[model samples]
Structures are given as structure tokens and as C-alpha cells.
Target: MDKIQNQVRPVFPFTAIVGQEEMKLALILNVIDPKIGGVMIMGDRGTGKSTTIRAIADLLPEIEVVADDLFNSHISDYDLMSDFVKNQLENNANLTTSLIKVPMVDLPLGATEDRLCGTIDIEKALNEGVKSFDPGLLAKANRGILYVDEVNLLDDHLVDILLDSAASGWNTVEREGISIRHPSRFVLVGSGNPEEGELRPQLLDRFGMHAEIRTVRDASLRVQIVEQRTKFDQDPNSCIKEFCEQQNLLKQTIINAQSLLKSITIDYSLKVKISQICGILNVDGLRGDIVTNRAAKAFAAYQNKKEVDVDDVKEVITLCLRHRLRKDPLDTIDSGTKVSQVVDDILS
Candidate 1:
């Protein structure tokens, strides 16, 4: 395990990324306010969608987690722990803190049900006549990120499991006379090529925002991207050394932004605007309004604004509300196009 950890390469730097500003902004917004659920990036292959997400993971500031815990429980926020941990604390057990790597757990497409939710240790059960529950990817992802590539292609059963866990912030398993439930609260990020398969509407609604990415078309930008990648591949050590300083600076910026998010307020006018947008778009349920409001506020916070304004709301509307919009049967209008129209009308 130590050797494997040592061999793992660092993710690309988020600040050095080019193009896909909308996708980048939406992701940053979610990081600022995880209550906004998480952003889904859907687009063509080779559009840097996955690359951008992995890069952001590297730029994120480290978090303090409970030592020896399967779930990366935040040391500062003990209130968010499961009942089991709460009970342990109530019994006056020593709770240790350790600075751990902030998680960015990737869910592979070929993952099995056992790998997703975990299963009982049959060997231990048979030998010691005891039931022991092993933690899975979801457990390790707690208080951090759970990234799924080719999300739309994930098995139907796995999708259901993820949806339920994400909504409740817990994963419960019951089988073979053993029942276990653990905290699984993590930012759920998914990326996929929309052209290959469309995500189920139910799952789509769970995401707070969605961004579409496309390959950079500008000749110079494309050349720069290729040149940088080639240079990095040729000399990873020097390339990473050169970029590490900027990556560290960006990590600090994210930490500052997180602290700033708490002070940023949302104006009543902007709240009304968010509600109005949801009403005009005919989006179902109150989640749309809530997510849009939160995302706009986070965007403002990221910009160092004290309060959310019309521009902030407008800028983030396409990202927040796009996935929630109803598809038109007669019209093939893209979500972005519809959102732009609404923003223009509201601002005008």
C-alpha cells in the first residue's frame, strides 16, 4: 500500500487549465458551498471534463479527519458523525485527529456492488463467528469528493444506490443477520459524454448544476495545450516542480474562499429572482430554487463579493438550473440557450 501510494501521480493543476470556464466556475462554486449538492460535467470526450475535476482535487486544501476512521470524518464537525461515533464520544472515548489527504475517490465504471457498498467479511464470520463490516469507496469519500466518470453508463443498480446514499448522506447495509449504516456524505461529481447516453431524469435532478464542455477550437489555445502536455509528459519532475508553487497558491485561495463563503449573504432581491427563474422555467420541486440560490451566493463569495447580486445569479443560472429544466418536445433548444434567454429577460 505504501509503494502504491508513492507511485500515484499528482493531478494536473486547476489554475493552469485553459478553456471550459463555465465548467470550471461551476465546480468551484460547488466546492465553496457543498450544500449546493454537486456539479455534473457532461460533454464530448477529450474535452478536459475529467481532467479539470481531477485537477481541482489536487488544488483543494487538506482537511483534518478523525484518525483511524474508515469514513474521513471531519475532526472539527463532530456533529456530522454517525450515531455509532456519537455514542463512542458520549462514552468518553478518546477522539484523535490527523491531517489526511482530502479525498477524491473515483468510481470506475466496472466497479461491483460489493465495491460500491461493501459486504460482510464471510471469512471472519465463519472463523470467529462474528460479523464485521468493511468500508467501501463511499466510506473513504466522506467529507470530500466522490467522482464518477462515464456516470451515465454506470449500472442501474449502482446508480440507485448512489442516489439514495447521496440524498440521505448515509449508506445502510442489511444482510446475513448483520445491519450496518455509516455516514457517506460527500460531494458527488459525475462526468460523461452526453452523446453516448443520456442520464436518467431522476438522477439528473439530483445534481445541483451541470456544465457542458467542448474541445478548445482556437488554434493557438489548442497548440498551447498540446505543447504543455507534451512537455509535462517528457519531464514530469521539472514540470511539476514549476507548477507546484502555483498549485499551492491556488490551494490557499480555495481555503480563503471557503472561509469567505460563510460571510457572504444573499440579498432578498436575488432570492426572489431565483424563485422567479424556477417558476418561469417550470422546474419541479423546491430543490432547484434552493440550489440556484446557494450556487449564486457561492459564486459571489468566490468573487469576494459581500452579497449575491443580479450578475452573480445570472452568471450561475445556466449552471444551477440547466439540468433541472424540462425538456421541450417540439423544440430542441439546449438548456444553456433557455437559461441565457431567462437571464437576459431578467436583467433587461
Candidate 2:
């Protein structure tokens, strides 16, 4: 019974996911360049938000991490290593390394600050005279992905904490004057159903991109999606087998994009136009411009391009800038449409 309970269930393949291209693209872009911040997805319920996010774990290539490290610290990159691991390296201590799947941490709505940010073991610290820290979701998510579902319903305080850590690329925990800081760099993906509620604009703008999806309007496409899901439910292994090729191909594309992202440059003129759109929209800060630039480059890298083009910018501009616009309750036009209009006007 214990063995059965421990068996891992099969995950639905990312390649098998139907439609939701914008959402998929946003996720891929974030994977290619995590520094693009993370993606915020808002749409109707049952649109495969959670499934799509979970599938990303299957798609990501394995990474080399310090063996036995709680933070999944990178073997060589100091930026990706925890303070504990860095200290060992500085001391010239022998370190073992292991390759593990890129972690995908699901942040539950009911989780407390201690659970998300980790806690210092006060009893152990006082008795042992050494800092004993227990890592949390943020630590486990280092060099990986952190997903928050129904983010709008989450407590605003928690959301703020997450945003602060994500932006700073580190999580700090302090208890009884003992503080522990570690690398918490991870792609922060969030999804929510808009009908339930909306995230505050200030909080929402922190996300690098926003993908708004809707229920499939096409009857045939809906039927196809239903059939695919039914097939997977009936025979999970076989369904996974069917899309194995596409999944491998996508994984390779993502890996290639990650390596190529640094070299993929956007033109100076394109940069000016992107900022112009932000300026016209009255975007609060330079985040819009920075995200748009990074997202465009990431998109180009995903397409295996050497340089960014107008088409690449066009493909991602809406996703990058849509959530940054201020809400106009009096205006009936949606934010996506407003961004599109500006893109067309400026790019035309």
C-alpha cells in the first residue's frame, strides 16, 4: 500500500495542450529568460491554467545543482547558489553535484509566510549555537518555476511578499535576530479567473507579461480538446507516448532558446518604438520598456533567430504591455485591445 501510494502519476504532455497559444508563448518566453519576470494569466476557469503550468516541469531540461543542497543551488554559477553553498566553495571544500529536473513549486493559497519564505530553527540555533534553517517553497524553487493559482484570491500581503522576493531574486528570513538569506530566483507564474476578482494594478504590473485566454469558441476545436483529454484520462501512458516526439522537440527548442537568448539583440529603432508605446500609454515606470525588450528578445530566441525583428516584437508586445495600462472603468475597450491599437499605430 505504501509503494502504491508513492507511485508517481503521469502528467499530461505540454505538446498535447490545445490552443491557448498566447498563454503557451508567454510561458515559453519566461522559461527562455526568467529575468523577464514572470507571466500572469487571467481568464475563465477550466482553461487548462493549472494543467499547462504543471506540464512545464515535464518540458524543462534538467539542471546541475549542488548535491544535498536545500536551495537546489547551481554547481558553478554563484548567482544561482545559496549562501551556504557559496561558503563551502570559498573554503575549497569538496562538493558533489547532481542533475535534477528543474523544480516547479506550487504555492498553495493557504500557505503561511513561514511556508513560503522558510523559517529559522530557533531551538536548534540556541542549543547548538549554530543557525539551522529550514528551507521553504522559495528555496526549493530556486533556478526553477514558482506557480500561484487563483492568485487574485490570495492574500494581498502574501502577494506583496512574493513580488518583493521575485523582483529582488532573493528571500530573507529572520527570527530572534538570526537572519538567513538565499537565492530565490525563479520564474513566477500566476493564474486566476477574472470573474472571481482582479489583482491590484500595482501588483499586476509587476508581472512581465499577461496572457488573457478565453473559452474555446470553435466547436471543432472544443471537441478536439475534449477528445484529447479523454484519451489521456483513459490511457495516460499511451497518450504521453503519442506526443513524446513533439515534447522532446519543444524541450530542445527551449534549451536552445536559453543558450541563444544572450546573443539575440533587438534593434535600437525597435527599442525606441517600444518605449514610445509605453510613453503613450503612460506606463508608470521603465518596467514596461524593459520587459518588452526582454520578451521580444526571448521570443526571437525561441524562434531560433539571431536578431530580433519587428514581427517578434509584434508577437509579444501585447502580452508584455497589456497589464501595465491603467484601468479605465468608463472606457469599454479592454486593455488587450488598447495595447493592440497602440502597437498597430506605432509599428505601422
Pick the lDDT winner: 2
What's the distance in Å from true for residue 335, model 1? Answer: 1.6
Query: How many clashing pairs in candidate 2?
Result: 0
> Which digits, one per residue and each the tens of the lDDT, describe model 2 over residues 26-79?
999999999999999999988999999889876888888999999999878988
Q: List, residue by residue over 149-238, the lDDT tens digit for candidate 1.
A: 999999878988886787788888777767778888878899999888889887899888898888788999999898877876777667
Clashing pairs in 2: none
Per-model CA lDDT versus the true structure: 0.81, 0.91
TM-score of 1: 0.92
Looking at model 1, report the run of 10 residues with the lowest lDDT sum. Answer: 1-10
- Give TM per candidate: 0.92, 0.97
